[model samples]
Target chain A: MNDVIKLLTSHRSVRKFEARELPEGLLETLIKAGQAAATSSHIQAYSVIRVKNPSSLEKLVELTGGQPYVASCSEFLVFCADMKRPLEAAARTGEDVVSGMTEQLLVATVDVSLMAQNVVIAAESEGLGICYIGGIRNNPQAVSELLELPKHVYPVFGMCIGYPAHEPDIKPRLPVDAVLKVDSYRDDETQVAAFDSTMHAYYQSRKGGNKDANWSQNLTPLFNQKLRPHMRDFLIEKGFTMK
Target chain B: MNDVIKLLTSHRSVRKFEARELPEGLLETLIKAGQAAATSSHIQAYSVIRVKNPSSLEKLVELTGGQPYVASCSEFLVFCADMKRPLEAAARTGEDVVSGMTEQLLVATVDVSLMAQNVVIAAESEGLGICYIGGIRNNPQAVSELLELPKHVYPVFGMCIGYPAHEPDIKPRLPVDAVLKVDSYRDDETQVAAFDSTMHAYYQSRKGGNKDANWSQNLTPLFNQKLRPHMRDFLIEKGFTMK
Candidate 1:
């Protein structure tokens, strides 16, 4: 197997971090790797805010639904899907300001995500561990204020990076047939069933021997509880019409 | 510097591709790497469709606004922001279908992007080149039909992977300070101005010695012409309420 494949295949999320600072210059190098990732039309519509201050980290943890790992991690970065630069550039160049458009927000959001993934992979290759905090979006306005995010820029996600304190098990996925379509999609019930079985076994055996909730049972309430309800008004208030 | 850092830092979009077949098992390995990237709450709401059939590739090129690279590339994969799995899971468990709401869409979109970025990095590490194709989104309906994408799953982007026929120069980025915010968001106008100068030099020296357009000048029309128009209705039709 290729080394990259080996690293990627057995990948697992690590939330527990050792109490250590990063090696010399790793932060700068990782950010550079992030900046090097592709941006939409080279607009580079994103920013990485390094939270080095302890008080600021505590605020970030509070904004991110009190996730202690976010505050306690060795390195915490909040990736922003930033239109502030482009908005400022437009102001400088005397161009029009596009208020409340889904197009711009979508581009910026995806752009930051692209960069964030590179940062994670680069960190992984250096033997650093990573966990993403989607909870950053839980309270976008608070996060924006704490991070001093200007208008047209919003926190898309946060990443906790450090040496791992524990080796989390590799999470199983739906089989390729269920997810990877060849020329067309197959919304096959059997495929999902097979995948649910795989997921159940994974939860049962590897994930601290937890009871295996099949794919449907685990997913239905998730859609009801957290993600589906809160995110719409959040994006709207953050200047995206999502038209 | 590490070889991975070199790959990440030196990445350039390769428009021209050499006529070479990928080694066997390369695509599978790439998909595995993509699947391993973090998903929101482990929902893993995304999929990729490999477009190997020539007729399908040709059609996809047309749908992608005549980006001929779509047809010419040795391997083309479409990254999709999929909510279909959760919906089907909901049906099996007697949960609501409207549950795949805006937040769910956002999660899947971010998840798909993270995976795509990993695939790009892994592909480059293995001596291949890739260019992400946001144009695949130009005609979502046609793409859905051609790829047989299901409801609640939209095409987020396409990717072309192959050996490079041309070695392009590394594109310059905004200066470190321009994009990297500290504990708080701060914009230094002087830094932005200086970075624009650096970018002008990068473009001038690399591409035939012509005077390069400043960053603001380059982006003015991009935000005007093609990108700002399409997303709202497209996303709506693809089943996101954008609530």
Candidate 2:
């Protein structure tokens, strides 16, 4: 495989980071790389909030479910799905802009995710570690207030980027056959079962066998509980009326 | 910039493609690279349907609003936001799975987009050209039926990958300052105005000055028109209630 593909496959989320800071202007460079990602219809409907204030970072650490890396990382950015700029720009053209459509939400969300993934890749290429903090969603309104996010702009997720202090084992993924279908959707029960065994072994052998749960069991908490049930009303309140 | 950063920043959507097939096993390698992207809580809530049949490709061309490249590209893939596998697996573990949370939708959509971006980067690194077909969302239900996608699975977007027949100029993006804020959100009207001028020059000079619209004017149709208003109901019908 090529170096790019090799780098892509070798990814693992890093939680522990070195105390050192990023080189000058590297964060901006990475964000510029992120802006290079394709946006739907050229509507660059996303924003990144870089938190450098130690107090704000500490506040974000609490807001993001106590993830210490939120404060510890050399750079913490909250990627926001923003329709405000585009809608305002279009409204300036006297085109009665539609503000809160479901497609608009989807487009902005996809745009930000694509952009953030590019930033992650660029950071990894620079030998920096990065982790996406979905925990930011646990308290979206608080995080929004902390960032002063305006209407039509919601934080999709936060990211922590810094030099790596620990190299975690890469988690195994589902078999390619399970996720990749030919021409049509196909049931992947067999593949999932096989992957369960694989994950069982992975969890059993990794880092002195500290964990015993398989992939499915690990997902149990996510599905069994009403996880983040507030997201719908929260998004709607933020002007993403899914109607 | 490093080669990887250069590659990430040089991305442009390639529509017209050479009539050539990809090297054997390369598509899977690209997809494997895609799976390496970080998933929320390791849910891996996504799947890819590789559409190879000529008839199906032609149908997708019609479904995606006369995008002939859907049929012309060497490979077409429908990236789906999938919760079926995870929910089913979790249910098998004797948990009453709660599906259709808005957070689930966000997670799966983000997962697929991140995964697809990785595939795009990997493909580009191998000198292959690619385009993201967001038009697939234009007729999600029809496309889903065509691909036999079941409940708890929805097509988020499609992608076309092939050798490039023509090189398109990389579209300019919003100023990094416009999108990146420090510590808090900030107004970007000045930056947006500057970028509008930048885009005006870009449109006036690129490819023999074929286009005249600036970035703001370009987004008017997308914002003024009720673009893809049916997506909300369609996704709801597909069991993504976004509740």
DockQ of prediction 1: 0.64
Best by lDDT: 2
In candidate 1, what are the lDDT values of residues A1-243, reduced to their tens digit?
677667766678888999999988888888888889988888888988889999988887778888888877889988998887876775677776565677787788789999888888788889989999998888877888888887778888899999999988888877766667787777767888887888887778875668848877888777555453766776777776575
Model 2 C-alpha lDDT versus the unseen true structure: 0.94
- If you score just chain A, what TM-score does every candidate get? 0.93, 0.98
DockQ of 2: 0.91
Tens-digit lDDT track of model 2 for A1-243: 999999999999998899998999898899999999988999989999999889999999898889999898899999999999999999898889887888999999999999999999999999999999999999999999999999999999999999999979999999999999999999999999999999999988887455778999999999988998989999999999886
Weakest lDDT window of 10 consecutive positions for candidate 2 chain A: A204-213
Model 1 clash pairs are none
Error of 1 at A27 (Å): 0.8
Q: Which is the leading candidate under TM-score?
A: 2
